[model samples]
Target: MKLKSVFINTTNCITPLGLDVETNIRNISKGISGIRLHKNLVYAEQPFYASIIENSLIEEAFSSVSSSEEYTRLEKMMILALMPVIKKMNPVFDEKTILIVSTTKGNITQLSTISETSAQSADLSLMAQKIASFFGFITEPVIVSNACVSGILSLAVAKRLIQSEACNQAFVVAGDEFSKFVLSGFNCFQAVSNEPCQPYSVNRKGVTLGEAAAAACVSANGQNALAEIVGDGAINDANHISGPSRTGEGLFRSVERAMKEAEIKSEQIDYINAHGTATSFNDEMEAIAFNRSRLGNVPLNSLKGYYGHTLGASGLLETVIGIESLNSGKLYPSIGFDEMGLSQALNIITQNEEKELNYLLKTASGFGGCNTAVLFKKAK
Candidate 1:
């Protein structure tokens, strides 16, 4: 059977930089970064750099949508991100529509509280259900939580569901918030950067965690679409539990499969939105993967500098920015990058430039040796 075509209809994001996509893009164009140094003793004993959304801002914005204070910070952010997308698309919450929620940790902060309500609220499924019910979604909501790849992986899942005739439309939402649990976990791993992250730079230290929520509307209909979903592939190397494959095996395979499904060669890719976590291993692994996939020459940039590592929201949030880049015909610079630090050379975009882009590739690698690549084409 011939598969159905899928397109990204609308997108929105809630971040420390801004609430709307245009606002965030404008800030990014001006070389603004949301990551900053914070001395929250709850998160860490020492001052740390992270892109944390202001609680006041979230409460204020969410108050406009709903006056209820029962929603968690992450849930409020997810609702705010999806609210505009739903308003723009005005999609019918019928059997043909499906909702997908992606997150690395949902309401993990609740786990810190010693209460039955808090424990129940920490359940991923319950969080998904609450968000779905808030929007009156008729179909059962699907949850995607595969480490950092959950964001873009949710989009891939949406595409397959629509293509397979399971649903005609899908609303994909992803988010993760700052919490002591997350901070301690990264601190334990010694992966938290002291300053704003610098991707692909010799001075790079480690990742700067961020909190954000991003949403996208996917449908078979192409009207007013942002970009067409061309192809996607996800692979696992099982090389290590925490560290990525030293040889870039999983990422390389995932990129190869995505390009193959897109029916494009390495040269056809105009730009790449890489999963540059700015860590020693991740940056090196990506450099190796791109070279192995014969895409070493492709202009690539990582958004980690601007937004920090947003965990589950990083992939989808960057994808939203990437679609804007395709539509605007401009490439955003990789903020905080000063010099090449990878073993394999990559053509990293340094300064913002006007480029007529046709095809874009978005990639993400996560724990458990998982890597995902999704290809997008400029919608005609």
Candidate 2:
């Protein structure tokens, strides 16, 4: 099905890689791993390093927000990323466009402090409202807290909102920050890797969490979009919330639905940006998922090594990287990978930038067995 009017005008973000687009692309394309010992990891006595932006840089970028809570970190990120888009974004505020947000543990870092108080929860919706209000789109805010796939789900939500004529335009934002609560949860699952993840590799460990903030403007007029979002879909394994289907059954179905919506044959896809978290189970399952999805032997890359798994931000953050990759005619390699660890020899990008290709697939699978994939066509 042809989309009537969905245009992604621009993308931007602040991540562990860099502050802006150019620097991030440069740092990430080099396959640089940003994982290091967290200076404050002594709080939990667990060695966990995530992609954290400097507090001073963020303060300078997002002057409108202050307060050193989880919201502050993500708020600063969204404000910085939205700065560029807002500079060129021309839309009627409060009436023209709508705001959509996605995050698994939205501002939950503040919960442990306030949970025992009168306010038993950290309202992520309140934070979303604050963001939209900051951008002068204080009319309506759509919040999606669907676990890890929140980023892509936000994209699909924005696209559908435009298609449904609910709004003339839509601004999609996704972000997440590392916190003691988040770290402890992953630690409970024993999913946290001590080293950088080797996606689709033989000597793989578990996933390393990362923090990031990202936003994009999707409009109906995509004739000159930076990247064309061909098709996207989301599905759940229903097997286990925190674990993946050993057989990759749910992921296979998710890819199948996405291709069906794209109306494009599987072989036409050129490369795949996998949700290669470097976790032993995730990597193994995704390998099977991709191969069964008819994406075997396709050049694949994962940015987790450089950005760590940016949790909620991975979907959009990686999407931004994918777009940057297409625009620059370069493909990033899967970092920290030495051997082919998975059952099959899944072709993973591990060297210098490869030549630009037309169609590529970007996928993400997270807790709750949530699986998502989006196909993109490089703008000609």
Query: Where does the lowest 10-residue lDDT sum fall in candidate 2?
Result: 113-122
Lowest lDDT 10-residue stretch of candidate 1: 178-187
Candidate 2: misplaced stretches above 4 Å?
A: 1-5, 41-43, 64-71, 114-121
Give lDDT tens digits, candidate 1, residues 1-380: 77888999999999999999999999999999999999988887899999999989999999999998778889999999999999988878899899999999989998897899888889999999999999999888999999999999999999999998899999999999988888889889998788899999998999989999999999999987999999899999789989999899999999999888889999999999999999999999999999999999999999999999999999999999999999898899999899899999999999989989999999999999999999999998
Q: TM-score for every candidate vs. truth?
A: 0.99, 0.93
The candidate maximizing lDDT is: 1
Tens-place lDDT per residue, model 2, 120-175, is 33577777887887778856799878777788778877877788788878888788
TM-score of model number 1: 0.99
| Native-to-model Cα distance after best TM-score fit, residue 277 in candidate 1, in Å | 0.3
Please report, in order, the local distance difference test score of every candidate based on alpha carbons. 0.93, 0.77
**Candidate 2 lDDT score at position 120:** 37
